[model samples]
Target: MTDTALTSEATHGVALSDVAADKVRSLLEQEGRDDLRLRVAVQPGGCSGLIYQLYFDERLLEGDATRDFDGVEVVVDPMSAPYLDGASIDFEDSIQKQGFTIDNPNASGSCACGDSFH
Candidate 1:
């Protein structure tokens, strides 16, 4: 597939939806550190062979791609960038599901738990 992440304004490998960015902003506000960035990365050893790692980080590493949405920022490492290209992150708050979800167009398959992908 094409690397839309590289071509578009979202060089961070993935795009964060408005709701997700807002939630992140809210969380950072709760923590009283709006300077922290949401770091997104890919890791191995999941049931689907690949897993996503997301968290707030204050440090910047080498070869990282960063994107900002309103007041929230997202950072992706070089290695994870290619794998997560064309991916989009969203937040959900409902009785059935309440958390962040990723919509990755490059993933061929995903685990039943929805925490891993291949």
Candidate 2:
């Protein structure tokens, strides 16, 4: 596979659909934390080369990068930024599956289950 250098502009974080944003915002409210941001990271050691990690963060690490979209704050670590560049986050609701999904153009091929990627 061809390796391309992913840029921050290309991956300034992800886009959230209205339903996804609403769900996240509601969860935040329930948590009673107003200063929290959604954190996404690409970690090694999955079936593929990388796996996604998501959580609510109130603090920024030394090399953490932050971006805003649709009134939502997305935080990513410096190490994970390149792999996640140009990735889009979307919400899906169906009888078979309902959750947030990532559409990453930078990834040439992902794992069979779609939980990991190279």
Candidate 3:
């Protein structure tokens, strides 16, 4: 595992692993878009009541907090910031699994499928 570094703004926000940032950069490059940012938000729903939403966003809403990992920018909304603070996002690529995974310290418990958290 590579050592993940957090920016001053990211210390109280989300941390993006180097691998994940690289992946995001590659994905954006493939799409040929430099205006989008990786948005991480928590929405109400799912088995555990709260589910994570990660996607590319071009619009920057009010009160959005951003952190840069390498050249990749990650944005978290004010409403979801508390739940995602201290969370680390990493990417894994292997025969067993392949995707971005969030490790949140704020989650008390998560669903069996690991898609949501309380």
> Total clashing residue pairs per candidate?
0, 2, 0
lDDT of 3 at 34: 98
Q: What are the runs in model 1 whose C-alpha is more than 4 Å off?
A: 1-10
lDDT of each: 0.87, 0.77, 0.88
Q: TM-score of predicted model 1?
A: 0.89
Candidate 2 Cα errors over 4 Å, as ranges: 1-13
Candidate 3 similarity to native, TM-score: 0.89
Task: Pick the winner on lDDT between candidates 1 and 2.
Answer: 1
**What ranking emerges by lDDT with the best candidate at the front?**
3, 1, 2
lDDT of 2: 0.77
Q: What is the lDDT of residue 25 in candidate 3?
A: 96
lDDT of 2 by residue, 5-84 (tens): 23223335555667777778888889988899888888987788889888898876666667776667788888898888
Clashing pairs in model 1, backbone N/Cα/C closer than 3 A: none
Colliding residue pairs in candidate 2: 10-86, 11-86
Q: Write the per-residue lDDT of candidate 1 for residues 13-55, one digit (tens) a residue.
A: 5889999998998899899996698999999969999999999
**Cα misplacement distance, residue 74 of candidate 1 (Å):** 0.4
